[model samples]
Structures are given as structure tokens and as C-alpha cells.
Target chain A: MDVDIDKIPKHLLRFEYPIFEFNKAIIDATHQYVVAYKPNMAFYEANGLKGWKSLEKTIKYLNKNYPEVFTIADAKRGDIGNTSSMYAKAFLKDLDFDSITVAPYMGKDSVEPFLNFEDKFTILLALTSNEGAFDFQTLSTQDSPLYKKVLETSKTWNYAHRLMYVVGATKAEYFKEIRSIVPNNFLLVPGVGAQGGSLQEVCKYGLNKDIGLLINSSRGIIYASSESDFSEKAAVEAKKLQLEMKQILENHF
Target chain B: MDVDIDKIPKHLLRFEYPIFEFNKAIIDATHQYVVAYKPNMAFYEANGLKGWKSLEKTIKYLNKNYPEVFTIADAKRGDIGNTSSMYAKAFLKDLDFDSITVAPYMGKDSVEPFLNFEDKFTILLALTSNEGAFDFQTLSTQDSPLYKKVLETSKTWNYAHRLMYVVGATKAEYFKEIRSIVPNNFLLVPGVGAQGGSLQEVCKYGLNKDIGLLINSSRGIIYASSESDFSEKAAVEAKKLQLEMKQILENHF
Candidate 1:
């Protein structure tokens, strides 16, 4: 769950750590309906040290109370070899998140370091949900689009089994082509709800025999209300999406 | 300087904050020779909250003591629109670094927010130093290599004037081609020294009318010695690169 302090309920602002409190309330309200709780690092890092503290508290709360629930650190970080290794250790080992999103611009060595962690998953950005995804991701290469090349090339790296791909819900049409390359891998689809992507459209082509799709809708559910009953409202929104996914899963099976 | 606790002198480790102390000594010795001091976020992040506190102290020290020198947060970060903006604010505004290195895979909107900040430069990754750079960067695109396309396409971005490119010093042959595309922009050239890149070769083609290059040698200089005189040894190494650059500049202009 991504928490923006500005959008948080006014009453919660009086607490010593509002972000952490808001996150706790949301998790308590919606944990039963969701399998994973992904916190985008940007929102936390933007607030500097306090933001980081909230992140630490939130993750600790999850591991302690909801140990079975998966957690994702949606930090699209990638760098050169040694640098990447440090980041891998920081998030996956130190912070102890189950997965962290990474960018593929630096290629093999930059990403493989993250995969070295035993059970940790590295979600690599294949096709993003933003307008900018059209900028370089879909560029015509000799054999296929650049995103396709990323998927193809990355599959050969060491510890490839630990990797997952981020395919935007907005680009549902591309899911068929993406699944053709890496059908078994779990796809973190993030552009649904607020980003204007249809849940039905993404699930139609994104699902595999393993039900390999993690459809994410950050703002749509988390920021469902700005009043004192924000967490309850968020749970309502989360329940709606959960019911939709439940129906999709039952029908698919 | 990249401060690795394991590589630091045993004596400094006793200090309350070894990373900050090591950075201060290194800056005191080498500040006169270097135009910029870049601390890769990975190094600071690996240590967790204490690491972040050390980074904050280091940056604050630089801004106060050596205000003229440029500081780079070598965090090759990029993401969707709103997310990228948060990173931009955290590093450029909140943390107040002069510049940051960003990955270009996410495209225009992901990068444009960084450029929106006046006087702050956004260094976009083009040709990286790592072996994995060949994975997608050198792919045969419709017109040119992927890195070249990155350089060409990024040049037309919203605040194009604020953009810089990262062309690894290891790939010196590509510098002439890179310079042709970004003649006026500064290129953050890493891979010299320990990474096996030759400064003279990178300068041969990478230099433009503005002498556009920020040659970086992190490990080679920072970890010069593991003994108590580490900072002194670091100064000697920094001096060697500075003298070499001085001679090259005198010969060229």
C-alpha cells in the first residue's frame, strides 16, 4: 500500500508517525483480501529520513503480524555491478522485503545481483504503465521491440528463475506477446484502476496455468477516501477488487 | 568517494560515524583536484538508517564546506511519472544534491520531471561501463544502436538543455559517436582505473568545445589504502588523475 501524507485522513496527522499509522490501519482493514502489500519507495524517500522510518515500521509490522502476506519494495533501482549488489542486499536482505522492482536499462550484471538472494524475487520493468513507456520500450529493434529484447535477454541471466516482469495493465494487448516469452513467470501488472486499465482486459491475456498475474491498483484503493474513515473506505475498495479477482480466478480454473 | 565499511581503515571504524569521517578526510585532501564528488546511493543504503544519516551528514558537509564543487547522487533511478517526481524531489530538492544519474528505460515523462528543476542536471544513462551494457544498449535498432537512439531521443525532451548522458569510459570508441549527438552536454564517464577504462582514450573522442566529461574513478581512488593513512593515499591517487587531466587539457586546447 502506497501512502501519501497529503491524502491521509486529517485526524491521523496528529499522531507521532502518521504514515505508519495510516499504513497499519489500511493493512488491518484489508490484509484478508490481499495477498501482497507493495509500497513504492518514492513516496517514502520523498519525505527523507522520517519517510524511511515509516517504511521500516510498516515492513516490520507486516513481517510480525501478517507473516504469510508477501511484501514488495517497488523501488525501480538498477546500477552497475557492485552498486547493484549493494542495493540487492539493502532491500532484499536488510530491509527484508520479499521482492523489489528493478529497471533493465543497465542489462545483465545490474539485475543478476538481485536474483542472487535465495527466495527474494526481482521484478524487472519490461513495459511500464506511463505515457513514457512508448518512448524507448516499444522502439523497433532488429528482431522485436526493445521490451521484447529485454525479456528475451534477461531470461538467460544467472538465477533467472527468481525474476518476475512488470507488464502494465494499460498495455494488456502486449501481455499475450509477453507471456509467449516468459509464460511461467509472475507478472506484476500495475496500471489498473486509477491508470485507466481494465482488469478484465489484463486478466484475459495475462493469466497462465499458474495464474501468473499480480494486478496492482495503488491510488484507486488506498486513497479511496480522505476522511476519518479512510481505512474503512480503503477496505471497501480493496474488497471490490478482491471480489473481481476471485470471480476471474474461479472462471479461469 | 564510495565508503565501504569493509574497505575502510580499522581505525576510522572506531569513530561514531566512519563513513562521514572518511568522506570528510577524503574531501579535505582531494577537493582541490576534483570538480565533483559522487556517492553512489547503494553504498549508503546498504547500511540502512545509519548509512542514510551518514549520507545526510556528508552532503551537508559538502554543501557547507565546498559549495563550489558539484555533488552527484549516483542513484540510477527512474520509474513511472508520479514516482519519478518523488525521487526527483527527494534527491534534488529535499536532499539538495546538485545532480543525479537516472536510467532512461522509462522514457520522457519519467525524466522530464527531473529537468523541471532549474540549475539541477539530470544525467541519463546511455552507454554504461558494465559488460551487461551489450545486452540491450548496443542492439541494432531501426536507425542506430540503442544507446545512440537513447541519446538522440532524449535530446528532444522537454527541458533538453538540462540533460546529460553517461557514456562509460571503457567504451571509448563510442564516445566520438556520443559526442556528435550531445556536443554541448557533459557526460559522466565512469569505468576509469579499477574498471579498466583509460582516461586518455575517453578524452580523445569524448571531449567537446566545453570539455564535456565528468570522469569518475570510485574504487581506484577511494579505497587506495586500508591502513590508517587511507585518506592520504587517496589524495595521492586523486592528484595523479588531476595532473593527467591537466596535461591532456593543455595539449588539447
Candidate 2:
């Protein structure tokens, strides 16, 4: 589940309820069905310091209430060595996210720092769902596309076992090529519903023995309805995805 | 001037002074010689909410006192369309930075949102100063290296005029090649002093009609001393770089 704070309904925002309140409502409605709750850091950050405070509150609420539910900070952050170390501390240690989405633009040093934290995952951007994914990610090198090189090179980093890759559901066909590169690593697949990607198509080529795929649908699930019964409407959408996931798991495993 | 807050004197941290105090002293000492002061977001973010508050205070101080100093939030942040828009608002609107660094891996949508803001610059990561830069940035394609493609493709985006590229000082030899691709655009060059990159080499190929380069030296200037007179020591180091920049301008322009 992806929680974009700004996209929450006007009814909630008009009442001046804290952003965390809306998040809490969503968590209450969906935690039982969710394996992880990925919050896009940019959305919280856009609102300034108060938004950050809301994020802190939301994370604390999750830890206290649903400790089993994984939290991914969808912050595509990477920098040089020392700077990357600081970002690792920010998201992993301070905010205590299970993992973070990182851009693989800067190579090993930028990534290795995040991998240093034991048990915390570093979800590197392999092939994103955005139209810009075509810009540089798919550029053909002598050996392979740039995204494949990212996967192959990052596998050599320290704590390579803790690494996962972001492979968009939009490009489900690419999963066959992607899986061939890193067969065992889990794939966080976004763009499933609203982006017009099929869950069945993603599972066909991307699934491994470990059932290594996290299919995400943000707008489709969250904005299913804008009425006062938003949480209940959200629950219906969540249940639908959960059922689809369950069926995929049973058949494949 | 790049302020790595944690690198401030042990006495300051020991006394539990807010990080802004250290930044204020640094700014007071070096603002005259400095064309800009960049605070790496990761450093402030590592300390959590209080750190973000200090970041706000630091930027406010720079804007109010040293209005001439261009402030770059050394935040290499980018995401999808809506998410990228949020990040644009976070740095360009909410925090009100003159510019923020963006990783171009996700392509146009990730970068274009920041460009939408008038008078604000989007410093795209073209070729960074880290060893990991060798991993993908320098990878050759049919036409050119990936970094050159980024420069060429990003030039076609909306508000491309507001864009600046990060061409590392460590690879001063690549400057001539880089300048040929984007002759008019400014390059924000890091890695000059502490990273052993020569300013003269960077200037030899990078200087344009506008003297278009912002060469950065963080550790070399800020960590010149750890004693009570640390800020004074920083001023002397900054003055050396300022003098060097003056000479380069006079000789080249």
C-alpha cells in the first residue's frame, strides 16, 4: 500500500485534521491485509516541518500498533559516501524504515552505505514505472541495458543479500529479462492498477520460489472513494488486491 | 561553502548548542568570500526533526544576512510526477532554496517539476564526484557516455534554462568534453580541495562567458581547525579559494 498524504480527500483536509489522523484511519482499515505500507517521503516533505512531524507520528503509530507491517520510505535518495551514510541514518536509524527506494545513478559507494545497516533493505531503482524510465534506464550498453548493469554491479556490494530492486508492474514483460539477472532478490513492483498493469502478468514472469514480488497500487486502493466512508471504500480495494495476491501465491507456491 | 554540520567542533556538540549556531558562525566568517553556501540535506536529516528545524534556521539566516549568497540544498532528490512535484515544493517552495540537486535517473518528469518554479534552479546530477560515478555515468552507448546523453536529453525538457549540471571537479579532464555538450549551462563542480581536484584544470575547460562554475570545497574549508577559533580558520581557508577563483576569472575571462 502506498500512502500519498496529499492525495487524501478534501473532507479530511478541510476539517483541519492532522495528516497522521487520515493515515491512522487508512492503517486501521488496511493493516490486516498489508505486508508493507510504503509512504512516499516527498508528499510529507512538501507540507514542510509539520508534514515531517506527521510522518514521525505515522511511523510511531505503525511500530506501536502493527509492528509486523513493513514500512518502506519511498525516498529515491543517493549521494556520495559520507552523504549517503547520513541519509542511511536519517531513514533507517532515525525514522526506522524497513527499507528505502534509492536511485542507482551514483554507483557502489552511494549504495553500500545503506546496505551497511543489518536487516534493513536497500530497494534500488532497477527499472522505474515512470515515462522517464525510458530516458536513461533502458539505454543499451555493450553488455546490457543500464538498469541490468545496476542490478549486476550492485550484487557485488557489501550486504548484497539485503538488496531488492524496484521493477515496475508497467513493464511486466521486462521481468523475464530482469529475473535472469537477479533471480532470488525480491522485486517491488509499483504501477499495478491505476497505471494499467496486470497483476497476473507481473506474477507470471517475476515470481520466484520465495514468491519474491511486492505489487503496489496506490491511487486505485486509496482513492477508491472520496466519500465519508473513505476508509471502508479503501478496505474493499485492499481486500481485492489481497485476494488476488493470495490466489497468485497458492497457485505458484 | 558546504556546511557539514556534524563536522563542527566537538566543543559545540558537547555544549549541546543547536546545529544552527555552528552554521551561523561559519556563515558570519565566510559569507563575504563565498558566492554560495550549500548545506547537505542528509547531514541535517540524520539528526531528525530538530535537525530539520536547524536546517530551516540556517537557510533563514543565510537569506536574511547574506542575501547575495546562493543557497543550494545539496539534496539529490527525485521521484515520479506527483512525488517529484512534492519534492519541488519541499525545497523550491516550502524551504525556499535557490536550487536543489536532482538525480536524472527517472528522466524528464522527475526533473521537469523543479524547473516549473520560476527563478529557481534545478542542479541535475550529470557526473558526480564519487568513484561510483564510474559504474553507470561513464558507460558508453552508441553515441556517447551516459552522462552526455543526460545533458542532451535534459536540455529538451521544459524550463531547461533553469537547469545546471553537476560535473565533478575530480574529473577535471572530462570538463572539456562536458563543455562541448552544454557550452552555455553552468556547472556546479564539487571535489576541488579535499578530494584533490585542481581548480585550474576545471577552469581551463569549464569557463564560459558568465564564468559559469560553482566549485565547492566542504571538508577542506570547514574542517580547517577544531579549536575555539574554528570559524576564523574557516574564513582563512575560504579566502584562499576566493583568491584562487579571482585569479582564474582574471586569467580566463
Models 1 onward score TM values of: 0.99, 0.97
Model 2 docking grade: high
lDDT of 2 by residue, B1-253 (tens): 3445556777787544358888888889998998888899888878778788888888988888888889999999988888888889889888889999999999998899999999999999999999999999999877889999999999999999999999999999999989998999999999998788999999999999998999898888878997789899999999999999999898876
- DockQ per model, Cα: 0.88, 0.89
- The regions of model 2 sitting more than 4 angstroms off are A1-6, A10-17, B1-6, B14-17
How many clashes (backbone N, Cα, C below 3 Å) per candidate?
Answer: 0, 0
**Clash count in backbone of candidate 2:** 0
Whose lDDT is greatest here? 1
C-alpha positional error of residue A251 in candidate 2 after TM-score superposition, expressed in Å? 2.4
User: What lDDT does candidate 2 reach at residue A75?
Assistant: 88
Global Cα lDDT for candidate 2: 0.88
lDDT of 2 by residue, A64-88 (tens): 9999998899888999998899889
Error of 1 at A1 (Å): 2.7
